[model samples]
Structures are given as C-alpha cells and as structure tokens.
Target: MARLESTLMAFRAKNGFDRGIAAPQIGVQNRFVAIHLVGKHASPQEDALPQAESELFQHELNHLVGILAVNLVSKDLLSADELLNRFPSHVI
Candidate 1:
C-alpha cells in the first residue's frame, strides 16, 4: 500500500495530471487503487449522494484490464444537462 501510494504520488508529480492508479498498473497483483483528490472538486450536496467516489473507483477498476473511461463513452461529448436528460441516473 505504501509503495502504491508513493508510486501514484511520483506519477502525479512527474506527469502533473494523474489523480488515481490501479495496483495492476505497476505489476502489483493485489486488487487495489490509490487516488488523490487533493485539488479536485467534490460533488455538489444537491446530488442524491456523492457520486464521484463510486464513479472514480469504477473508472480505476477498468485499468485492471487496461481500459479507460473514455473507452466507455459511446458517443461524442455532451453537457451535464444533456447527459441527465438522455440517460438514467445509473448510466451517468
């Protein structure tokens, strides 16, 4: 766990944009992930729940197989309102 945290920190320091990392990314067979949300925004209180936590974990889990969130988006970009209107809450 300590190594994973340090690896993630080092990666963010070097690349300047990574916020999370899956253990498999560094050859760790353990099922785990390290995430740093220090400078990021939290979900609004109006949300039914803090969706970002679940969403981010799910996003990172995909990295176990080398997949990414962008690979799951089936269409072009859409605004938040558009997404809410087009898909069910679970899909967003």
Candidate 2:
C-alpha cells in the first residue's frame, strides 16, 4: 500500500534504521496483518512464520486477558514483596 510504504519511508528517514511494518485490518473485518520486511534481515524461508505467529498470537491474547509487559517485570528489577505492594495482583 502507498500509505504503508510512505509511513515506513518517513520512519526510516527520521530514525536511522528500516524495519518490518505491519498493516492490520486492510479489508473489511479481516483479522489479518500484512507484514513488510526491510533491511538485511532474515529471509522469508529462514524466518519461520509458525513460531512468529504463535508468539504474536500469544501477545495479542495476553491483551485480551489483561496481562501486559509491565506486569511481567524481572525478579531482579522488583522483589516479590515490592511488586505485590506496588501493584495489586488483580490489576495485573
């Protein structure tokens, strides 16, 4: 799509790197993403879709379940007691 390409170009110009971009919900009610891979990254064959799709699906599913990155902090970053005290268990 022209919009997607222009956006990516603008981002690359502002930043110093070009990366993959995903265009979601292109068609009516289509729950699919169109991915554009840039730079000298892994080839389509090398980059397995099954594993990537699984992880992506899991992340999206987490949003539906209300489990976010902030909740999954490293133990080193915050102790169990500190984490529990800082954020309610139910909120996470």
**C-alpha local distance difference test of each model:** 0.78, 0.54
Quote the RMSD, in angstroms, for model 1.
Answer: 7.3
lDDT tens digits by residue: candidate 2, 46-79: 7454565556555544544456657877657877
Q: Cα RMSD (Å) per model? A: 7.3, 8.9
| Span of 10 residues, lowest total lDDT, candidate 2 | 25-34
What is the lDDT for 36 in model 2? 48
Which ranges of candidate 1 are over 4 A from the true structure? 39-49, 65-67, 70-92
User: Against the true structure, candidate 2 has what lDDT?
Assistant: 0.54
Give per-model TM-scores.
0.57, 0.33
Off by over 4 Å in 2: 24-92
Residue 18 lDDT, candidate 1, scale 0-100: 77
